[model samples]
Target: MARFEVPDGSTVQAYRFALDPTPVQARALASHAGAARFAHNHMLTLVKAVMDQRAAERSYGIAEEELTPALGWSLPALRKVWNQRKTFCAPWWPENSKEAYNTGLDSLARGLDAWSRSRHGLRSGKAVGFGRFKTARARRSVRFTTGTIRVEPDRHHVTLPRVGTIRTHESTRKLARRIEAGTARILSATVNQDSSGRWYCSFQTLVTAKTRPAHAPRSSQRIVGVDVGVRADGLLVVATPDGCEVARVPAPRSLSAAQRRLRMLQRRAARQHGPYDPVAQTKRRPSKRWRATQARIGKTHAHAAAVRRDVLHKATTSLAQQHQVVVVETLNVAGMRAKGGVRKRGLNRALADAAVAEVRRLLEYKSRWYGSELVAADRFYPSSKTCSGCGRRKPNLTLADRVFECDGCGVRIDRDLNAAINLARLGEPADAGEQGPAGSGPVAGRGATRETDPAKAGDAAGDEASTPHHHQVDQTGTASPQGEAA
Candidate 1:
């Protein structure tokens, strides 16, 4: 059976295409989105009621599962509830498509499951709770699948499942060719409204390419170490051998400037004095001019995000295409940020700008696509403190020391380059004796053992990673290179 796994070698390529939607299509989208919100809110209410009933039952020595039927945990059961309550749905809600209603319940189901799991400490990320009834701005933030799904062409538009006879602002691309070649498969489609108030349909497609492996691994198939930093295009590209510097893309323009602008917009919005009554939770829509300005501010933020994503994609693609094996140091971003919570907004934004997670994720898929290997070193490998040439760990190393000075080998090198070289050294196959400290670390819980769940499997696999002899692979999920640089 086919299963989902993180991309390992370079094999995956993604393309994001812009879309154009017509007026009818826009209306359909609005309905679906609204219906989705309605379903989510309704389900939340149902769940909360069940919880309250269960709590009351427990007070009287009763059980929880007895309330499941009223809660409607299953999709079909929830749909039945929605069908019965259709009359109370918003007037503007679309009547034709059941899919819109289904979509809402789908989201609610996932949200419910997440909230349930998190409450029991069985899920990652921040704990979620039943959301408050949503309004326009807050409700707009939802993720929907948008892949290569074909639409039935009609006189003035195309028919979609939940959204019917929607017009397109632009014609479809070489879809006919894609269909003929049989390489494209429609995933799902999403209707998004831009800050410009323009609607677009984004279709996600699975495009297949006959990717060829790189011509023979560089005789220096020796691992290449990478040092990720916030200085260059969010990355400080260093080579393993001789601590060579390869790429130095400047930091993309920062969001700080845009953030200031957004703050100004928000402040202005807050200052609008009207016949506003605090007791009544209502507000008059802003003037057209004000709305225009707000949109412009939103557009600015969007542009910055686009630039960051584009740059990351290009850098990751380039790295994946060239190397047989990649080595990178595992960084403890969470731990590093813990001490600086006050400046976390800026730091977190910077981290995102660096796109460290995206790079790692992309490398996994790209490496699989290219039949290359990615080696991650342990978090405690001390890539920064240790000398690249010698196994001397500099306990006194400080962040201020951009250049590494090794007391043992009397060698000096750029800190990033040294780390990269160390990471590259770890790419070589290792013997049992050189398993390193990480491999020999203590095990607890299900430590590196078999797991039935996918999420747990990932954690288990991570625990099983052993430190390499040359460049140590550490617990932080990065690989350090060892030996003489390159």
Candidate 2:
């Protein structure tokens, strides 16, 4: 008997309501944020104090665990601090949300535990440390929680447990349908603000979704390989078994225009205000004339982001729906930038802004819904140099080579398309030793997987300080190592 784990698919739907907070309501939110911050800092202080005490006690032969009951990394102690400070909170602090303080403490403790482990040699990678207390500037950032939700459609209001009935910019999406059907149950509503200062609410809803069966037969699954680059043709090169060509999509006019406008605004902004001062910790507010320029500057950046987001969503959704498998090469974005020549900075910046990791993340979850698979080839996999048609590698490939010509097989095709086809051919197996789908041919770097030789290692990850690395994958799943492709 194959015992399968039951999936926890929700039978309820969530509704998001943008909050229109009164002055009083805004103050209450500030208070809640403060309480949360206070709890976090207080817990951190205790941790540091206890650790310091333990270090001093080592001379007396006292173990660190001796202070476990008094100054341990427990949430209860942090809650005690919250309980004591709760009295000093603003009058609007909801009594019903008394548990919120504890919730905040619990979250802080978990963060601390992760930080401690990362910092104290228990975890791999970099050491983590306590974040500094949130200042007024940082407090401008939005807060979200997966608890305390209430909705009243009659009054066109939604009340969070901590912060009461808030206004929304727009009515909840799909909430009315779910409510009418009586299948929706709201668990928590998380409120967030974007960079442009637009508020959004994400309702944690429990609703049923009709799982659609695949229209395409399982045996006919077509996998693809995508290689992304900054080029005139859609920045995406896709390769299939027949041949390779660029993925054709309408160029985003609005985004390109916004980028141009943003450059003008940036220049204006620079002229208005001098260089940034890290030590000063305050952005110099320019003259009254500059304020208008500032607003235009903010709007320009926000518009560009919105345009990029729309394009990315469309691209990712299409890819997720059409294919059963996807594979993409990881290009070294950092090294490309360091070997900077003309226009390298612009290319680097675009790649960073594309948010490749975010796209991959969206695809991973979206794939589950469609039963498709997405594979991210190792960063060292040389998709561009290797000929898709023939198994031979092209050692002296250049960026100017728009078309991929195989010396061994005499196959010529659009460079980007060939790379995409190669990635698609990789299919289910991307690891060094595994065989690719039947006739797709061997995966890249078959025998030269060893890392002992520096030259054969493909490219090295640049220093953290110098690397403008972004972990984002483009909609096509091709990753430029430092995050920019186009």
Top of the candidates by lDDT: 1
- Give the per-residue lDDT of model 1 (tens digit) for 260-320: 7888876775565433445586765556656666777778777777677777767766676
RMSD of candidates 1 onward, in order: 11.1, 10.8
- Give all candidates' CA lDDT scores: 0.54, 0.54
TM-score of each: 0.73, 0.71
User: In model 2, which range of ten residues has the least summed lDDT?
Assistant: 456-465
lDDT of 2 by residue, 147-215 (tens): 546566654667776576787666654575676677665544445444454555556554445232457
Q: Count the backbone clashes (under 3 Å) in each candidate.
A: 44, 23
Q: Ten residues in a row with the worst lDDT in model 1? A: 443-452
Which of the numbered candidates is closest to the native, going by highest TM-score? 1
